[model samples]
Target: MEKDLLKTPIEFLKGVGPAKADLLKTEMHIFTFGDLLTLFPFRYIDRSKFYKVSEIQSAAAEVQIKGKITSIEEVGQPRKKRLVAQFEDSSGRVELVWFKGAQWIRKSLQIGTEYVLFGKPNFFKGKYSFPHPELEKAEDFVKSPMGGLQPVYPSTEKLTNKNLNARGIAKLTKALLPQLKGVIHENLPVRLLEHYKWPSRQDALFQVHFPTSIEALELARKRLKFEEFYFIQLSLLLQKDRQTVQTKGHSFDVVGERFNTFYAEHLPFELTGAQKRVLKDIRKDTRSGHHMNRLVQGDVGSGKTVVALLSMLIAADNGYQSCMMAPTEILAQQHYNGLSELLEGTSTRIALLTGSTKTARRKEIHADLLNGQIDILVGTHALIEPVVQFRNLGLAVIDEQHRFGVAQRAKLWKKNAVPPHILIMTATPIPRTLAMSLYGDLDVSVIDELPPGRKPIKTVHRYDSNRLQVFGFMKEQIALGRQCYVVYPLIEESKSMDYKDLEDGYESICREFKRPDYNVSIVHGRMKPDDKDYEMQRFAKGETQIMVATTVIEVGVNVPNASVMVIESAERFGLSQLHQLRGRVGRGADQSFCILMTGQKLSNDARTRLETMVRTNDGFEIADVDLQLRGPGDLMGTRQSGMLDLKIADLAKDGQLLQLARREAEGALKEDPRLQKPEHAATKQFFIQKHKGKVQWSQIS
Candidate 1:
């Protein structure tokens, strides 16, 4: 057996020709013999236990029995047809049914022949039956010596139609296993393997697909999962090591008058302990003279913006320029306005260079930037344009950095002779396990606490039937000089549908609140930029008591007086979006409230989301639940990261395993960073071979 043989094209396999190979690749992504071997079963059926028909009492459990067919018949019309066979054992009789594949089943069945049947028993209308049961002649049944679990591979209808169902796949795997006897070799170091007490690569692979016992199955799973995650962590940590050792960065060594003045006199609120700790971490990175690649994660309204501003102030104090890039124009504008207001009396020159900026203003800002006059620049993707040059750009603060593509962010690296220190911020909370994998290269800072004097936004769930009560509560809050937001989800995902919903909601608010006493503003994504800005401005200025809008206002809307948020059809929104929408109102000093309204009928996920929102204001907890609801791939959109190309390891359930793998990888790298030692050579070669062309490790943020 040779290692190269495992890399053979799947089409050349005994049971798989070109057609079946193509189907396997298209349906299950099994392209090579290696892939076919690694396609582990999703579940298994126990072949050891056989029960008599009369002994079965509950449909809750599945059972296998040996029985003889007494009679076979086809019943009902063509639309709702079924093939029924009366099966009898020593004590009693039961009906075996098939609603599909009846023709093949009928041809295969032999009356009065003892056969083995496996399926879940169902007591329907007081009659015992087994639906779509698996059957085979007793003589043909292959018995496992240990009564082990029979693997059930995943297959699609297209493959099943071609005689490549779960059983068919298992047969192909059995055929491939003999060829892989000594071909599979150990990749990890002997010491590391012994420390973890993991099975060999060959043993793990063999046991994973065809386990002789439950313990063997679990051991195989653990070994494979560790291998997958360990390599990912090793790759990431190695990238980080390279970046830290090789990359030179500009140092903001001084916290001069600019920073001191802002903190002493101009700071609007006291920073939370978490914010201070993060700021300290940033300060250390800047002073360390290493290209600071840091990710700042915080929940909404956690004062991440203030930390970013102060970090920029430090750059400005040290005669360097700083820029903050946001994902959206609205968010950019909000940052510009907020920072400008924060630095009102200070001489820090901040410029906004969004797409909406006039040509003349843009030219002036660009010139000012190059001349080193503008201390801070804030904008959207426009900041990445070639024309937007900076004189002495030292630091970049990217808000919601995930919204930008790798190419777009990479452009900023080339803007300076030495890549500027980067501080990426995200209000969306990421689970710790996900963060370790997704953002392993960059150091992470977390601002987990909200600022002092800010009250937790009281969140509540409501049904459509309680709309009037919610509206009354809003009126009461409005009477106390606080503003309210009435948000509605789109009838469908289209902007037109969203606009229509906003319009209808606006009309209803007008009819309910009525006249000159209560003013309302409406904003949606479909509206013109100017029009949306006008409505947003009106709402921010407190000219309107209530603003009806879509999720366009989910980010960067800071109105201190807005204290109530009424979200219509909140069940349609994800947990993160709902949290962000709720964050829009709690900026004010008053006790803010968020009312989530949905129909009586809600899905289990929706119910969990709403209940989580209502139960606790902890964004991290909500994010964890969201990760469980939607796995790591969808949670952070990490499918593109290649770190999530896991076959068995689940980010949600395997956090402990991930931590262990990362720690072990970190320890291994610390011992031999380049894997130059003889024992580590195989591991290094295996990693290089596995990830050679598939991943761009440097592309990870």
Candidate 2:
């Protein structure tokens, strides 16, 4: 068999001509034989059991019966025409109906001929009928390759119009499989095959398309899924290995004065065990002289900022400047103010650069940054500008790193002669399985514990009927010198509707609280940036007892005095958004409360989300549930990375298999890092072909 046979254009296949091939390519992206072969079936139907006409029940599902068409006729008016045929077996008879393809079906029907029929039985007024039944001669059915478990390929309306439906695709696959007998090379090594006791790639592909039994189909799926995951893990692990050995970075070898003074004297609170463990990991990475591309994941308000600040202090102690880039200006400003206050009695210098910075201030900042006078600079995307050059940038910290693209992050690497050590942080807790698949090329550290003296936010669910009681409780809390946030959902597609809701809610709250006695601040996406910032500052300064707005303050607004979070139309938000909004109030030592408001009617998923929020404050647990509910594609915007484009394996359900694949890939690389061994020749060849002409973005975190 030739190696390029599978690469042949799909139009060259026996049954698929140019017209059908064009439809396949345009509708399903199938351009070659290899692409068609790998288009695995989403489901299968068992055709082995044949039911007698007398045994058919009204509630019966899809069934096959051996019968013959005794009579045929056309019924109903011209526009509502239907082809009806009386199909008879040993005991009784059933009607086979076709509503749309009457002319072609009626002409093809053979009277008094034994045929096999398959379809779901629909129970009408007093009889069971099969609609659009698939009819095949008994002798032909016996000789067909797809007799037992039939594969059902996905199709589009355009493809189906050209006779390229599931059955049509099955015929093409059956034709292509025979040609692939010896052409499908075994990519896994013999040792791995023997250890896992799996079938060869050729046999698995065949069995997946046309299985003899349920067990064979299961085994085939397992083999293919493992192969997919194993190759992905192998690619990511190889990237990490190359980056570690080839990339050089600055070595911070000393525990210098700035770090010591901050840790010993000015530390606000004792570091948690998890934070300490992560710091130790960072310390090891920086001292190894290899560029550090590490991700630090912690829940909201889990003290990640403290870890970032300490790491930057280490860079300053080594006579190198560090910069922290945020996704939004509000977050950048918050980080700048927090870090400056934390370093207040020390000699370390810090500055902020954002889009709103004055021209004079910008020039001063740029000059100071070039002269190495600014020890640490923090800002939004402005930090990545061409003018913001660092004299000797030893480290770069990114907050909410997922919000930035790979190209934007790569720009930071070009700032210095050698790329600075990268520390990426995210409050959106990614499930471990997703993290392994998405960020496997980078080292990961998780701060799983919250700081001391912080209490878990109490969460509850309430319908609109309880609005008065909720408002009364809010007034009581306000009288105690505490602040509150009343947030409404802001969906992009329904912006006007959401804005109206916000406005109405704000007016009613103002009427209930009565302005002079209780001041309320409003902020939303439509407001000017300056106005939004002013409202937020008013609330932050304790001038407003209640802040009514949208989810604009979801990420970076920090007011420790705000102890209550009231989310309206709570069912409209995702679990992560709800969790982030709840995090806004728990920053202070006082007991924070999150009240979810919804209507009487709720979806099952919405109920589950509300219950989960009330049951636990664990971000990881919530993230796991979110992954199961939303899948890996929508979580954390990972779809943009193109890494999660999996064909068969599911990140939500394949965690154990993913772990096994990671372990196997790691072991294989450790034994033969370059894959020069004879046993790994197939794997190496496949990797090269898969990654050919692809840009390597593993150097950027």
The clash numbers for all candidates, in the given order, read 0, 0
Q: Which residue ranges in model 1 land beyond 4 Å of their true spot?
A: 1-3, 143-147, 491-493, 638-640, 694-701
Clashing residue pairs found in predicted model 1 = none
> What is the C-alpha local distance difference test score of candidate 2?
0.91
lDDT of 1 by residue, 528-551 (tens): 999999999999899999998888
Candidate 2 to truth, TM: 0.93
What value does the lDDT take at residue 676 in candidate 1?
Answer: 78
Clashing residue pairs for model 2: none
Measured by TM-score, how close is model 1 to the native structure?
Answer: 0.96
Cα-based TM-score, every candidate: 0.96, 0.93
Number of the top-ranking candidate, with lDDT as the measure: 2
CA lDDT scores, all candidates in order:
0.88, 0.91
Backbone clash total for model 1 is 0
